[model samples]
Target chain A: MLKILVIGATSLIAQETIRHFAADGAEFFLVGLSADKLKMIQDDLLVRGAKQVSTYELDLTRLDKHQELVDTAMETLGVIDAVLVAHGTLTDQKAAEQNVDITLRELNINFLSAVSLLTILANIFEEQKRGVIAVISSVAGDRGRGSNYVYGTAMGAKSIFLQGLRNRLAKSNVTVLTVKPGFVDTPMTAHLKKNPLYSDPRRVGKAIYDAMKSERDILYVPFFWMFIMMIIRNIPERIFKKLSL
Target chain B: MKRYESWTRQPKVNHQTIVPLHWRDELPDLSQFDKLVLPFGLGRSYGDSCLNEHGILLDVTGLNQFIAFDEETGILRCEGGVSIEEILKMIVPRGWFVPVTAGTKYVSVGGAIANDVHGKNHHTAGTFGCHIPQFELWRSDRGRVICSPTENKELYEATIGGLGLTGVILWADIQLKRIPTPFIDMECIKFRTIDEFFDLSEDSHERYHYTVSWVDCLAQEPQLGRGLFTRGNFYDPPLGAKKEPRALPMIPMPIDLPSYAVNPLTVKLFNELYYNKQLRKKIGGVIHYNPFFYPLDAINDWYKVYGKAGFLQYQFVIPYKETREPIKEIFRRIAKSGQGSPLVVFKTFGDIKSPGMLSFPRPGVTLALDFAFRGEKTLKLLDELDRIVFENGGALYPAKDARMSGASFRASYPRWEEFADYMDPKFSSSFWRRVTSS
Candidate 1:
């Protein structure tokens, strides 16, 4: 059986991803911040005919707990066949700028924490030479405007980091997949807009699962996003900065 | 368990199934079940019509088998998943073609009926559902059922454009129209104003079987509705010249380009060039059916060009009497928005009855346009257009729509409840969940 570790397991996307792989009889060790949420997800997975299900309550921002979380997961499950890093916080840019502490917290939660966890997982996969890493980034990183540039900067950095990881792990037979979703209708952006090409979490989960199975290097969730963002990304900076977009 | 959040992208409210069972070819033996949703072909539908989110989504592509063909009568029977493109490849060379075709031929027969798709020939031949004589539907409550206009009339009507809420379609028998030749005698006409364009469309409708116009959305004021109208009908091939058969080929876009590629300026420039390039007021040419019907098919994975943020396709139809007013208002609003994206199309639909109770068409004009998601502004503009459609007594095509309100839906499709009554509760989807719950 293919063993999988899903970080931020309670997320809409993570839950769906877990359920997708679980239905395929893949073993899973789910990690999330809420014990209640993890239990709910675990129960749902078991009912769906998952091979095995385990859960760990994790505060991803706590870098000190990163190694322990991975250790616990590996001990509970067998060797990890895949690692899905689906947890990230979307801090309001204005709020982050207002407070220095908030800025650091946002940076750590969105980028540094993910880097710390993925680093350990990547190293383990590199040694095993038989695993896949899937990261969920955002299209907001393509080009940051005044509205959400801080969050976009964090995502941009994460994307670059994942790219380098993919290149470094190439020879080791470990595949790294980057997923850039535009606007997703999750609790993260529920307040923003309703169905604004906001991909359903289930769709994102399936796309990621399919990408993992196909070993695709990168996938834009809701395929159309790839083109929509292409049109946006091609605009010249001089012209782009002027628009209220 | 909801596997991939992405799959839940386009579900109905309250009926959204968190987990979707992904099956490739073989359909699960549904003999034991009481209700199931059949989602075959492409998921281009606007509503939860085909999706039974909570139950099973029987993929019928694997059952695709071309059964019979009448060389003389031009009648054919094929499995549900057999797309129009597949049919064109087999029949076009023999001078036979489908009675009607939608903008995209990638849709399966099952989808074609589920939506009661109408094409450029709708004015002349009616919708695709009208040409279909018989079909086999597998229902959970009732086993294998054969239906047609004369046989199981209610079930047949319910199944046609019924959004597959009735059952899984196994195969269908349809009447195909025979043409003198595979080539079309086409003409292109340019109109500087919407009024002039409608006049040309009215004139062409009397003379030609196929009529459509591509509007330049970027045009302002005096040129707001400037467009190129193309009309055609099959014609006999010249004597002694062998007909050059054109095959429909699949095109796929391999890579995702960066966002920010298509903006107002770029699209404006492109539309200007495209509109201007067709300098000839009228020209006769023999073009492939694929390009004529499914232009987007020429470029595979064309959606990827939209970048990481997917675009939304908004298509609505107004009754013939109120067509000009609503269309003019919609165009005026679009031009004023100044956020240009290519692909604004307009066409006139002929007398056609909706197969399903809530099916979205009437004898009138239809307009389809694509817009990038721009948060509140886009929604506001769409809301304005929705009001226009509602006021004009026109409904939005649910297949190509993603963001329509319940109130608007109620206004657009007055017979929604009649169709809703037949919805198998177990058969729920994200699209249905959103609409119902909200």
Candidate 2:
């Protein structure tokens, strides 16, 4: 059975991805912010067929607590077969743009905090020589748009970091995967208007599970997002800057 | 603006705001919101019951997480937003099954309870609410009320089939049926006349746990009520018998086929082919539960076959009066109109009483048909059928109703006034507003 460690275990996408693994009788060490939410997910995973589940509560934004979480997971699982960094906040781009504190806090949670955990997990997986490190990035990272540049900036940084991590971990056989999901109808996007472009979280979750199992370096969930992002990325900067996206 | 439509995709309404409840503990402070809010699940209700027009919709799907399950007793406690599909996936491997399941598995437990949904096995098992021993209802006024048969009995009865107006069902405890395997032993018998259909149904009711029929509504007088009668029970295999579950790959129908493509001529041909597809007069086999219960579900978004204008599901149950004349007259009108319903389900609900005050099922014969929305033409036909049903002391299922008169609703559910007393003042729905106000 695979021993997996999940950060942001309460996040909808993470919970769905873990459900797929749990059905295979995987053992899990989950870390999230809310103890109540964590406990609920722990029970859910157990019922889904997880052999064992243990949870720790700590806000991911607290970069200082990163090491303790990893140490606790290592102690619980002995050797982690996979680690999923699946937690992040969707900040209000308008508020983020107006306030430096808000912008910095958003960056801290979405970029710095994830980087902190991934950096530590990368070392442990390197020493172990066989494991997978998967992180949930966003398609928004592919290009900065006027509508959501603040959130895009943080995800863009995380995406670049994962690219380098994947390169270094490739030699050690510690597969690093970067999941770029398009508009998913999760709680984070509850306020946003949903359209045909918005994919269900379960679909995105299944894609993440499949990508992690296959050890793919990069994945654009729904596959169509790959082309969508490609078109957005190729647009001329002058033309892109003039149009509202 | 994002407009939410029911499964039929008709009468789309825009909720003022959609608040997603992700965790059970993280329920929003409903008191803060002045406007009436209704908890919405998978939006499988065929019509307006699931819609709130301009009111808030508390999207409970995110709160879909299992709380507890007793393997020995086959009792499961899970968040109300959990789908039957999810429940089956979790419990089927453990030799358990939902006591009652509708034609589709996409419906949330909350929706099932609110609608008091019944199924093919309803003759034996009753409504889905019958299996729900207890659940937590979160109201704007009363924070959390645990409703059951003994405690808060009125609220419990009112909440079931209360049309999501009573309150939000947070989590529910369901008593699951213990099955030998995930397969069902099914038999299909063809009947040429309404009398034969009734005879077959009456004969099978005592033997089969699940019973239903598919009628070709477009057939002429001789074969007017001609259809196939199917009956089944949980597959009980020989000792040490090995079972391999199989499910048909879901074929997604196009988002919208042209309205003209699904007219009477095409529907008639399709119905004819479907009826004759089974060459043998009788066939029996062990089949997986998925296809057995949800034949239409095998085709994802099967409603799209009705076309871009969308369709309306008209399901009504008329009390048995020792004759099948009411049903025949109704079928005669539909056949005469040449409306050509591509799908029609006919079943007889048994004496198993439901716990809900406003539950649709009773000791009656129920017929459900889908009509493509074609302006006033479809409405006129249904209105005529409603007269027959209402005169016969039948009730239109609120879950499947898009347009039933206020008088028809009140006449059908005599307990609606009593049920109104238990409804949360801050909870309302489009269907409720339309039927009650009129």
Candidate 3:
């Protein structure tokens, strides 16, 4: 049985991911910002085969309370087998570019706060010497594009940080995984036009769970994002800059 | 935008699709543009009830938002575009379920009320409108108004099963029922004949809250009407723990099947295997509410089985007081035509009164069948069945009727003239135009 800790438990992707675990009778300590919503999910998870579900309400951007949330979950689970950081927002690049205040706030919520939580969990996992740390990044992090560079820059920094964590935690046997889901159809992306490449949130949830179980260091959901991102990355800066991609 | 098709995939037509982003957002006034308009939800209607040919469609699905809900009392106020599936996803874990649901949960709340859909439990619960205490009706003429059984009583009765001609339902308030869990204790039995079915159904109805059957429409005179009857009740046990239902991954239809895939021989073979699948005379077990109620939902886009030509679902109810001769006659005609439908459902409707003036269910035995579209041949066979059904004082469900003679409809539903007075002059559908025109 997996003793998992899921942040942003109310998110559609996170909810679907929790469903996969609950069906297997896993114990979960769920953290979110809303008490009522969290409790509803707790009841839902209980029905989904979760051995036990404990919910804590704490806004992820409130870095001051990160320690308290982690301490309570650790006490409840004793030793967490997996720490899934599924919190982040799809930033509006145009807004971020125009407003420094918005840019910093996006960085605080999407990158810095995640880095803060990861640093804390990595220390606890370092002592345990065996735990998986997974976080949701995007294929956009593979390169800076004019369409979404402001948000892409933040995710890119975190992806690089995960690389460093994987290198540092390897000796301690604590695996750091970076999950780059291509284009999952969730509430977050419901507004965007979809095509054949769009993935269902449930399937994306299963893919992430499978990657963690297999202890993969880097996972590109649907497997096509890797090739697509690779091509985008290898493009010459001259042509890329000239194009409106 | 691509042209949309209903579940049957028949009457394929083009229309401008409009999705409102907010409740107060103005819906395009059809009178201003001189365009016929119909509100589209999930497009689960088996026919043209949700479609407007060569006009405009106000896709109100984007207006989906629950206005308010009292969880303890299970009274919910939500936007009409919200699907029954979405409501179930929210309330089921809280130990509550829809009071009445059709064979599928994909229908929108507005759609359910508009169709006045009935289910296996219609014997006790009546149709969907019986559970919908009130809703907000937004007509171009009346604007947004609160319509209920008590308030705007005429509109309330007309809008239920009014086929959306009454107006677009902006939001609905539904009354849900409490249950112990989402699991149902189900039992299945095999009956050899219609007489035997009546006896079995009478006995089962006394014991189970839900009962329906699948009959072999292809059977000949000697073996005719053999079927498997299924009854279920919400499984009750100690409530120390809640068990959530798990669904298998939905398998979307990869491609359209060949049009010739569903001939009489194939239907007969499938029915035989299905009828004999349970070797035991009686089998009972506990299963999820998903499979027990919405079996086809597990298979996404199961409609593709009908191929490119799509299909037509013929459903009718002849009063129990009428002789069984009409049913026997209708089946005889269908079998003789060599167009026996692969999916045939049979059920008994109890004395529960429907609130809708145009509601289809009555005290009767109902049979619903689906036939692949063979154009004029299929229409002729359906017309023959319609005559038999109407002559026996039965009516066809307007929600499922793609093509029924106006004379047959007028004969079946004598309240049509009274109901027609309330129809919104600015509202119409392909179905209304098809059935009401001379």
Report iRMS values in order: 16.1, 2.5, 7.6
TM-score of each: 0.59, 0.94, 0.72
On DockQ, the candidate that comes out on top is 2
Write down the C-alpha DockQ for each prediction.
0.01, 0.54, 0.07
Over 4 Å off, model 3:
A1-136, A145-151, A165-179, A184-193, A200-227, A230-245, B1-4, B18-41, B53-97, B106-110, B134-159, B162-192, B232-260, B272-291, B405-429, B432-438
DockQ of candidate 2 is 0.54
Task: Estimate the lDDT of model 1.
Answer: 0.73
User: Quality of candidate 3's docking, in CAPRI categories?
Assistant: incorrect
lDDT of each: 0.73, 0.88, 0.81
Rank order (by lDDT, best first): 2, 3, 1
- For candidate 3, lDDT tens digit of each residue in A102-167? 999998888998998998899999999998898988888899999988778878999999999999
* Model 1 regions more than 4 Å off: A1-245, B1-38, B46-55, B238-260, B320-323, B421-426
Model 1 deviation from native, Cα RMSD in Å:
15.9
Which ten contiguous residues of candidate 3 chain B have the minimum total lDDT? B248-257
lDDT comparing candidate 2 with the true structure: 0.88
Per-residue lDDT value at A30 in model 2: 92
| Model 3: how far residue A71 lies from native, Å | 13
